[model samples]
Target: MNLTITLVFLVLTSTVRSLNILGIFPYHGTSHFLVFRVYLRELANRGHNVTVISHFPEKNPPANYQDISLAGTIEVLKDDMPVEKSYTSIINTALFLTFTGKENCEVMVKNKQVQDLVHSKAKFDVVVVEQFNSDCAFGIAYKLKAPVVGMMSHILMPWHYQRLGIPYNTAYVPFHFLEGGTKPSLYQRVERVLFDVYFRTLYYFVTQRSDQNTLARYFDEIPPLDQLAGEMKFLLVYHNFILTGSRLFPANVIEVGGYHVSKAKPLNGTLKKFVDEAKHGVIYISFGSVISPSSLSHERVKAILEVVSELPQRFIWKWNNKTLLKAQDKLYTDSWLPQVDILGHPNTLAFFSHAGMGGTTEAIHFGVPIVAMPVLGDQPANGAAIEESGLGVQVQIRDLNKENLLAAFRKVLDVKFRERVKQVSKAWHDRPMPPLDTAIYWTEFAARHTNFTFRTAAADVPLYQHFYLDVICVFSIFVVILVGAIRLSLRVCRSKSPGKASEKKQSKKSKRA
Candidate 1:
């Protein structure tokens, strides 16, 4: 009887399955790292052993989580592209990613810890990798023989979707960096097409080759980058149709935009007191983890300060500098604050933001209106989307001045703007489950069912065929043949008509004679 009970216990213990997940995100950007960290934490909380290879690791991670830091990689990347200079332009951003991605990949593959993980007998159920800049991480998936899932912390780019055979029509889905509202003009559409073609060609000829060479250095045999990308079981995009226009995505692609946001934590005593004491409400200002506020030109900073001083509302500015610019009665300056909690506060009136998707989504979640001052990458696009949604006003960085800032504040502070954002927030919260729960379900589903069946044939199809150039060629040939036939028949009729006319004239002459 004791032996039978022991056997039953063993069977029950064996039936409780747990998974091993490996996340590879070697990017030095804090925003990118934070997005991956949220998902990794959730997996750990759900009883999975999660190991992340990243440049920035959490200070105190949960029990089942481990972080393998590639912090040295950031030093090498900083030398290649200085952090002080803003990479605002699309070309500059792309070039920066191209150079830094190659360097980071080399650093990651050669790192002692990562090397051990690769060469050892350790196995992972699923491998999650950042798909934006570096493709070299795919080597880890290949080495571990695990199903791969690519995670994007921003909206899907045209090139990214194309790899999975998803349609990325330039007409509707503008290029990621194009900074304009929805319903683009003809000129904007043309520019979007040209930019898409240029980037795609550049990636195929240059960036993709660099990635392949890097992967080849570590692996004996590997598939082409496109094939490896298409092999991903799922892609978790940090975007939603509410912000990005609704479009059809492959079954493997999942939207987990606000996975990082959660119930507002209690603020520290100092911040809670400051916010609670504000009489006219408070404004929260932040440019995100990257893009230091001190880097702004003196003129721009002065203009912002002037506007803050003039405002009747109290302000909390997240300026990551040792010294404050200027002390004012109404302004509170700090290196960092709980942005989501501040936005969630009833006393908080509006957000002054750089319009990053993370901050934009949080504001939407908390129903806070915004005055967006976009800096780089997708910030401008996010700002435009916010404005189009009637929740914010966008101020061009170059056009920053006291007048512009004040006008933007007034526009966003309107009660109508607040109402609009509240409606959006309600819609966001109306989902069947929380974003984190949905993300976990899809992630585990991918691990259980390594799906390659959902991949579209579009990736394998040639560009010419994919765009139906052959159909256009065939139709052109038919039109040409029809036009030629019509011309020949007209010529034949002309010739016969002249002959008949001459014969009739001769007959008339003979009869008269």
Candidate 2:
């Protein structure tokens, strides 16, 4: 009996070993950070010591969770992001991320709290860093001497393809910022190629170079930023094949797309009564946490308001200034709303969203159809996918008129659209394992197999070698030489032929005469 008890104790202890994990997410975007918070909290819940570095620290803490807050860093993104698609808008966003990313990195490394952690004898078993606009966190993970795991809150960036060996077939895979699904027209394919080249070049020459300069200020021995990125043990991408389309991924690239979405908590207060008692169901309208509704032009706001007034469905608009939209009996406006609970509610009919990845995933999870008005970044592609997948319709912000807005709502509210969305939601939830478990397992997998080789050799190969351009050059030279030799031989044979010789002599004699 004592031996049996001892064996059981051993088994229990072995199954749940506590690990020291560190997560570094320096970007100040709240929506982006929310996607990662779920995994960090779960790590703490699973008896691991998890420390996170970010601006939005938890108000309440669990025993094993801690935060090293970089709360004072300048907010990288604001309401300045344009609400329309244009060449100027694209350039503005690229330049913004490039320069502001450097500023954020500089501020993070210089912080007193961050410096203390860096200088201390901190021993983390594994480090997870957000693989977004900046890669300066990789240097910190190296300083801690821990295996690194990269977590992407949305679709992979343009530059990530070559380094990670993920194929970027421009013919099918639409650029993140463009508005076409997998089956794009010829014009969109051409646009995708140009955008891909532009972003990749900008990231490599400007963004990575700037980040490396910032890293050199603090860590003298850190490798190049791209090299450290290529060294990551695993890449937890917040995308699924159902939405992003089935694409190839390296062994280390794990898709835990919908992990951040949790079971909706019961709504309470005025919000609960508002959603529960809506006679014709509710339309949840939010532009997400980044873009403030106040930044919207008065014309756009008026258009939205006019359309909502016409609809019989009650509106729950997430507006920053509740006074901006005059309160009507049918409309409920708040600065903050329980978005997930509202979407999960049966009374919720359609979602009017900016099509940010987090909100789009939640809408899909709750089987709520979306009326997407994409503004910037990956939203255009995501919005297009929503329309292509039959999950809903997309209304471009450039065309945010009452006519278009109402049409989009009518399309999403159709019975067939809702039923199709339910089917997609069912498929999305039908994963082999829950997304949270998949994330935790891979994160632990990285820690446990620290010595294992997860990066592909393609990461180290030069572009020319990877694509066999040199071999193509050599083959071209051989073909040229072979063609030249055949032409020379034919000329020689014609010169030496009896008929040709007779004809040449006759021509010479006639010229002499």
Candidate 3:
């Protein structure tokens, strides 16, 4: 009777604590949404009522899960970004994001389904939004009168550090876009500082301004987007200190790095057979969803094929188009792959990747050494980190040739390199609580403490005050005044000394006469 009563009580308690969560992921990029949807689905599986608004909706969802699809409203990003890094490329990327953010915000707000929700008297415990290149979702969350939770698919954006009080000291901490690792030379550190300033300035003036204007068109009297971002109850960033070096973060900035990486599912029959039949293990090559493999130049493609043909190991390439390689026995091509399962397989030896955050984290988790050929965005930083961490080597795309590709493969396949990666993977998995559980716990915690404030005082402080520029200015002025006073006194003492010497000489001559 006591056991029966206890079970009933537990069930009642769970029912009482169930929450209604509204998740907004406006971006159309599959890679960005891929990291976000896992947690949103898990919320439903855990018995929370979840309504998701996004471009990609699940085909079938749990009974408690609902989707407001934004499909066909925006174009997907595929092979649209250039692989090269230059001044023009940087400006173009920034402008693309800025304009895209505004358009997405307007579309999301004007959506009929979203407008219905806005008009309805429904209540949500929390509103979760992706903290990517847009802040327009925050305004929607504000209208719902629910506490906000910000989710980062990757590391915090350069502008986020100041508001969230995450230490971004450029001396040792590298920018996401730069190829520099944690420990950089004098020149690289200077480059980091300059780029940091450039990114923040561009974001504030161009990106934020564009997003804010879009929000104003739809919502009246909405709090500033930056203010809304700062007021988030929790900011779950996809980062782990083991892979990313230790850094200071405020209490609200939770590190739920590998939450998207679920346990490896069984590979399909053909893939399993191919992987298992490898004589010398497998090399899995994928450039992620953003960069299509077909976009590669013929020369680069030929170089990759030449190197792969020379290798004894089997290769599985994620190619969206047909390939010219004739090694049917040694190569497998797939448009869509079970990446996590493939990486988890014992027969998988190494990963040749574009070093995107999603793929790089998975490589580290599986202890698979990487042959990183970074092409764009944060890939450079990730590639540099992979090399610095002894997990793999980075080959720049411009320098990618048969010889370089072969050498990179050789380096990662070394026993020492493989062993180091395994050790790091072990450390990565040694967390006290599972990343997903930590995320869920914090999500629920935010719902329970909706009235509580988690933002640091630094968020409330202005840039000049936060960096103590005013204090430095005062100290500098005092130092200059003190130096001037000392110089004036020294000049006066020198003049008096000359006069005294002359007077003494005159007195001596007069006394002698």
Candidate 4:
């Protein structure tokens, strides 16, 4: 009996700490870095070792983890991904090619950096990758000898998993089409259609080499590309209860909620001073790190400053560099704002932002209403979430003029706006688990179920599945194509029918001969 108890205790201890993870995030964004911080820290808190590879060195490495800070300096996390090789152009080309499905992720698998990292993996026992970069995940994870887990932040790519025909609870996975405003325009709709076709062909192209390499890495023969879905170990998506209802999910896909988190800290005095004096309450404007204030147009900058200047609410702009010094009179302009801290202040009523995932998550964390003026990509989706959930309002870039800015500010303060945000805030806070703890729990969950496959409808699907389900009208197209081909062939055959015309043609041929 004592032996049995001792054996069970050892198994539990081994299961939890058995994970030796190497996290790969070549992304040069703070938002991506912070979202995973709580979870990794939680894992570190559990006495598990963790490692990070980012654009910058992690100033505070996890407590128990080792950081193989390969990207030069800890500050490189704040730096840009090296794109000087006309890399951006290659990426754009890849994106364009991938829009239809030309996948080059395998090249990443075989890349020098990828190979070096895989070769360097001596003590590491598990691999964790951010799904934000499909290339990085496919490359490194394909080569790693350890169990690999992928973390998907946005609904955009997680749905790609769904598209592959993996069974997943759709209610939980973030859907861009949750609301009408987010629905694609005619051009966007057309682009998406062609993009899928292109991407399918592109995936075949990009992964052709790496897929072979991945197979060889495991000492296995290469299988059909379509079978790639079944091979992945596990996938975790950042989602909460409101986001996920009772939905079917693949054996591998898990919802590890609260990926969006702020490094815990109290507000400093300078940040606090600005927040308290904003009599009309404060409008926190931030665009994260990559969008330098120096890059925007003077006219647009002037308009933004002027409009926020007009607002009765005290404006606290988080600018990388000052565009308009005029706000020095009533507003507080700071080159660096402790964004999460400022959002938590009592005087803050609304956030004027580009709706970055980090900023949005902070807003959600504090339950602050948002005036989301999305710039591009997932920012729009994040902004739409605020509106969709009735937590805040979304303003477009075209409408950032003074009048529109005032209107948006006023709308956020309206009784309805506050009420709605309060409701969402309550919902977010009322969760059975806080995001940090939830993240911690799921981190261990991944450690527990390391053998599951993280597939959604996407990995299990084919072109035929899409046609039968998403494109029901294509059946008519098949009929039309068949009928047209048959009709045209019959017409051609009839044209040379064995009647007088054929006999005349034969006689003419004989005369010529």
Candidate 5:
């Protein structure tokens, strides 16, 4: 009996051996950090030791998790490039993120604590890096001699899939930032191709070179960024088919869309009272973390407030400013609110959002329809997808007015929209396992299997060959040769006919003579 007990203990211990994981997420954006934090917390809960380097560190972390602060990065961004005025276009956003990402990477790698951890005898089994504007974090993986995994906050971009040798067919998969319905028109498809090419070129020449220089600055011997990217064993993408639509994904790519979403906590006293008193239901309004509603021009803010105040439903707006606008008794404003809990409330009718992926996913999770006011980046695409799903109506910020806002509210509040959202909520929750479990399982699986065999040969193929431009060139040459041969044969036949006619004329002349 003692021998059997000892054997059982041995097996259990082998099954749950703890792993050391290092996560590098140096971006200063709160939403980005939140997404990474979800997975880090999950890993810690599963008995893995997790160390995270992020811009926003947790005040009191769990026992198994450690947080390294990069708060200074935020101050640098605020001083150099103001959030409200910086990201106007796709190009501008890319440039801003690229520069800031590199700067943050340098700051983290050069920190005394981080440098000590790197040079110490401490070892990690795996390194997970956020694949945004920074590729410098890959140096940590190289230093520890550990396999690397990439974490993405939104849908996979062209460069993300291309690194895994996945086909980036722009004809079918629209660019992540483009705003269009499921069925793209001819012009829209052309525009998608152009946008894809433009961004891919920009990343390759500008962002990629910058990443290489940053990596070189830290590590004495490191592989090129492209080669290191291709060597990644797994990618955890924060997207799902419910909103993004179904598409082919490579074996190494895993979708954990709502991993961060959890059961709604009870609202605070003030919020609970306000929500319970709303007999006619509530319309929750928020523009998400980065873009404050108060940052809008006075005219725009006034227009929005006027429209919401006239609605029959009680309004709960997330206004960051201390001053409050005059409104009816039913209208309420707060500096911050528990968004997910409010969305899950039975009294919540519709959500006014910037249509960010995190907010959009939460609204879908709770069966709340949306009034999308997309500002920039992937917000427009998310808004378009929400509208295409028949669960929301999009209102452009520049075109905001009383009539348009009222129409959008009425459209999204219709019973059909509510029913559609419920259907989607059901489908979104029907996965075989919870998203967090799926993420943890894949992350551990990657740690165990350092080498991935599922990568496609397309990664090694030249660009010209991957797109079949060489085949087109060869086909064009063959067609030219065939046409020339046909023309030559026709000329020979005509010459023969003239020679035969002349011979016949000579014979006739001889006969006449």
Candidate 6:
């Protein structure tokens, strides 16, 4: 295909509507960039021009986005996301969580460097950005003379704002566990509830006080809450596949499960040889970004490998931080594996993963049953979803020993596991287009049509509107106090009535004297 022609085809897609996107991912990581990188690539390939601002250059990005000096790709490294820190870890979550939504939103506006990028404002048709980086992202959007489109890489869809009353970056998704499957533990539910409550309070404060700083700076006067658009205004575009078990999203929200089908290079020969030679199929295991494979108890690690080594199946393990380690001949060790290629192989029957969204999506997409050892975030819930759907089994990291590992592996290799996988995989693949294409189509739709309709709205509605507590409970308490006070005064008056006659007589006597 002629490169120029591809650009025209991609760009002409916007004849009905053209969107110049300010695509921003705060830091570079598998989760942060993978789906978005593909989504942007499609836009550039389709002929729509993309100006992606990221921390680093993506290798072999679709079309020469950065080198496309002519009508090609315009990729820019924003130098914001640090390369070393971008590696996956749970430790980063606390930092990400600590940044108040408002402060984060304000950071982008205040930063001179980020602001300078926005200084040369492009009258973009639309802005696609992550919701997490509300700090700089919305600031970038504010500079654009176009509508903003918010994209979430996580499973939490924006329509959940209306559907479940969850706000952007406020709280985690409520896991609706499967029958006889792992549900959110009591602790998880409480933590979510507490976090939800905190955001709920924070949102109220932000809404109520939004205009104070704006008015103080602009007019030397404090303005009312209603005047604040800085905190209130923005639209959401999310990446969700229905396979994750979500429903009734608003028309305004888009579901682009776009990461599923990438043009990422396939697996190579040394990897393929291990898969092909393993007559009993392969057990591929890797914990995603944050937790180091070295963190695993050496005993647990050896036990898992020892058991798998004994199994009839072949094994390919993805281990990071194994630089000084020696591996048995039956085992394969690498910091990374070409996951898609391995999953595509017929002999690759199962994936032992940390249950990251990216990995889970791939596993389901290829119809490979999973043996999950979920450690953080919504991994537990996701793992539960997989198990509940009858597609796989999830063992807690703490429970991952020789026996459990073998048990989970045996369950996945069973004929039933393969059958269940085919059912879901068919559903996943048979969709009208790849999840990514759907995401693009919906993103385009969201871009062209600015009126984002939500499934239901809980943002504007307060707790009184939701639980009716203030209306019913508070008012009832007020009425009880009022009635009690009135009765107390009446009783006092009655007691004083007897003294009134004597007091009047004494007053008359004093007057006569």
User: What Cα-based lDDT does every candidate model obtain?
Assistant: 0.78, 0.85, 0.84, 0.59, 0.78, 0.58
Error of 4 at 117 (Å): 6.6
Model 1: per-residue Cα lDDT over 423-510, one tens digit each: 8778776665567766777667777777445566666788999888999999999999999999999988887897878998999999
Residue runs of model 2 more than 4 Å from their true location after superposition: 1-16, 75-81, 495-513
Off by over 4 Å in 6: 1-18, 59-92, 99-113, 133-135, 157-188, 198-242, 263-266, 322-328, 451-457, 469-513
TM-score of 6: 0.72
* Per-residue alpha-carbon lDDT of candidate 5 for residues 195-264, written as tens digits (9 for 90 to 100): 6777677777877787677667766777777777788888888878887777687777888888888788
How accurate locally is residue 89 in candidate 2, as Cα lDDT from 0 to 100? 87
Top candidate (TM-score): 2
Model 1 clash pairs are none
390: Cα error in model 5, Å: 2.6
C-alpha RMSD for every candidate: 6.1, 4.4, 4.5, 9.6, 5.0, 8.8
Q: What is the TM-score of each candidate against the true structure?
A: 0.87, 0.91, 0.89, 0.72, 0.88, 0.72
lDDT of 1: 0.78
Q: Against the hidden true structure, what lDDT does model 4 obtain?
A: 0.59
After the best TM-score superposition of candidate 3, give how far the Cα of residue 406 lies from its true spot, in angstroms.
1.4
TM-score of predicted structure 4: 0.72
**Candidate 4 runs further than 4 Å off:** 1-18, 60-63, 73-125, 136-139, 162-188, 195-230, 241-251, 263-266, 323-327, 450-458, 465-513
Q: Model 4 over residues 286-352: C-alpha lDDT tens digits?
A: 7776455555567667877777657677788766555455346467777787787778887788888
Tens-place lDDT per residue, model 2, 1-513, is 646655664465469679999999988887888899888998898889999999878999898999998875675454455566787888777777777677778878887877788779499999999988888899899888899999988888888887788878877875788877788888888888887888777888987888888878776787888888888999999888777777789888999998999888899998888778889999999998877888888899899989888999999888888667655678888888899999989999999999999999999999999999988888988897788777788898889999999998998899988999999989888876678878888888888888987887767788899789999999999999999999999999999999999999999999999
Candidate 2 accuracy as TM-score: 0.91
Once fitted onto the true fold, the runs of candidate 5 whose alpha carbons sit more than 4 angstroms away are: 1-16, 76-88, 169-171, 181-198, 326-328, 484-513
TM-score, cand. 1 vs. native = 0.87
